[model samples]
Target chain A: MAEFYSLRVNGVDREVVDAQLGESLLFVLRERLGLLGTKGACEQGECGSCSVLVDGELVCACLVLAAAQSGRDIVSIEGIAPAGVSTDVQQAFVDAGAVQCGFCTPGLVMAAHSLLERIVDPTDTEIREELSGNICRCTGYGRLVEAVANVAKTRIALGGNRG
Target chain B: MTVSVPTSVAEAVSLLAAAPDSLVLAGGTDLMVEVNAGHRSLDRVIAVDRIEELRDWSISADRRSLTIGSGVPYSLVMDGPIAELVPALAQASRTVGSPQIRHVGTIGGNLGTCSPAGDTLPVLAALDAQIHLRSVSGGRTVSFSHFMTGVKRNSRQPDELITGVTLPVLPGWQGYSKVGVRNAMVIATASSCLAVDESTRSVRVALGSVGPVIIRCTDAEDWVVGQIDWERRAVDDGVVAEFGQRCGVAARPIDDHRSTAAYRRRAIEVLSARQLRRAFPNG
Candidate 1:
């Protein structure tokens, strides 16, 4: 049975009708709401290509059920920056050449965004651990690590609120 | 199809009683994988992670033990006081999946999954933790050894749910370690936990992923007592090697997708010795 679900996604209350019972949040975001920024590669939560923020907690969106997210807040990569603009983390990724195929860029950006939100000035070990779930096979981890580190340094200098 | 997200343990029990065939979802780390793969279609599901009572945990009376709710995530167990109470469990939690997985996976779910390789089981066995079970009829507790019957198998009845696990607070040294293809987010190819009880001058060692159930090495444990000097609180390098060798021999490892039987046997032997020495290192 399909039902209507109203979820506060990306700072907006979006109504989704015809919601299937076992539909994943990744599917709802991409297919239902048309928020295609959150990519879906491996639906089994192995690849973090579908990473997103559920009430400020970073998780694999593919692993979460849309129905279970009744009143929760979800922030996808599409809402990470202002309209027609890129956030520092996203910009840093392009500057550092961390976007190879670009399929994993959204997930990496979202994960880094959430990490900076919580830790502010994170160490290399902390940054690596936070982004462990998100895999970028083509880009390799070095560039992504550098991009996140670059953003972290600037965010710290900016009083750590910029991400 | 109906998915029940109960706010309390009582509500969850009632929901299950009404639908005995309902699948229990915790963390959804393991279950959702199968669901996404189209291996099994679930018509009825009960999400237990949301129930607050299922996540409740606290120190036991007399301060000699700790009671952990079934829904307590691995991250909490790693950061909270529970980690300090059982260092082996904390060590195991740190190695389970990645940060995202740890944020949701619970010890109770590990028990519910009952995978022989699930990292938490060996620690629970080493600690001799008590499995708390609940049903619409009543509640009961069982030892970890008795709770696990076989690989992905347990004595849990269809109508029963795991409420929590209670483990003793060991004042002595204890630790856990595993051998995986990679360190960050790989399942244990072979794992071992060692706990030293100074009061009895005894040690408990358990191996996982190398048998149908986590193997408790009584033979190795007995030798550990004889080998370690109570007064010196130390054991020779040879004694440690022999102890690990004995424990490894007791495991019934088989060739699996992750590793071969011969390799798992050797890995357990090396891991057991390494964890034992780390817990009771010579200064």
Candidate 2:
């Protein structure tokens, strides 16, 4: 059974037509909406390559049903930046050389943004725990952790709303 | 395939009664995996995640128990007042997948699945929690021991929805421990939770991934209670090793892909002993 539905992704309502009930939010975001930035690896929730923010809470998009998330506010990698500008967290990733294959960067960015939004100055343990879902097969966790911590310190110095 | 989103418990139950075969979708942490893996088919789905009634939690009038809504995610249990009330549950919550999974994964989802390896089941079993279920026909509460029937199976009827769980606020230390291949985002090879009740002067020990369902070690619990000095809140060093041995012997694990049966039994023993020692540090 295929039905039509609309999702508010990145503050815009996108219509999905004739989607199967089994279609996940990750599938719809990439294939239907042409939002290829949200990668889909290991379609199961284990990889965290499809991590996205649903209603401002981080979740693996692959685990969410597209139809069920119709009315929720979804923020993907494409929406993370403000008008084509990279946020401090994204810049920190570049400065720290956290990108290797660049496949897990979008999801990692989403996870980092979600963490910094809730905790302005998170500890190293907190950063590791929060980013645990987004696995960097490149094994760039040392620099990834550093990037997030640096951004956290920068956020505190800037005094709020910098994420 | 139709996805029905109900706003309240009444509507959800009515929808379930109308379509008993309707698959209930909460967090989709477990269900979507099966669907993605081509293990389960989805047609009519009743999405209850948005229902406000299922997301709210409250304390009893007497403050003797806390009733957490089935839809309350593990993140809520990992901190704040609920964590203060049930530290074992908080510890278990922290061990669940990661922050992303914890933000959406609910304790109700764990109960609804009833997998033998579910991280939260052992803690719920040790606490002697009561599961609340509702249907268009009526409502009833089942004890944790009776609720889980077998691996990935429960006593819940097709039309009945799990509403919440009520756990007593025991006046004692409680802790949870598990052994997995990795520290984070890894499923437990064997997990154990030990809760000590000062008022009853009794101990409750539960193990996961070591039996058909969450196993409560009645023999170990009774034996350990006798070894402990209730007044001094201590236990003899000689008795702790034997307690661990008893818990290991009680496990009914099998050789699975995740681990060997013998290793799971041994892990349960080690986890149980460590949890007991943590609960009674003076000993």
User: Which has the greatest lDDT?
Assistant: 2
* Residues B105-149 of candidate 2: C-alpha lDDT, one tens digit per residue: 999999999999899999999999999999998999999999999
B202 Cα displacement, candidate 1 (Å) = 1.5
Tens digits of lDDT, candidate 1, B1-283: 7877888888888888988888998888887777777876778888887888888899977888999999999988986688888888998999988777787788888999999999999999988999999988999999999999999999888788899999999878898889998778788999999998887778999999999999999999987887777776677898879887998998899997899999999998898888777766762
lDDT of each: 0.87, 0.91
* Fnat per predicted structure, each in turn: 0.41, 0.76
DockQ, cand. 1: 0.64
Model 2 error, position A42 (Å): 1.6
Q: Which candidate is the best by TM-score?
A: 2
**How well does model 1 score by local distance difference test?**
0.87
Of candidate 1 chain B, the 10-residue stretch with the lowest lDDT total is B274-283
For every candidate, the chain B TM-score is: 0.98, 0.98
lDDT of 1 by residue, A1-163 (tens): 8778788898999998997778788989999999998999989888889988887777888888777777777889877777899899889999999999999989888889888877777889999988888888897799999999999898878875674
> In model 2, what is chain B's TM-score?
0.98
Per-residue error at B100 for model 2, in Å?
1.1
Error of 2 at A56 (Å): 0.2
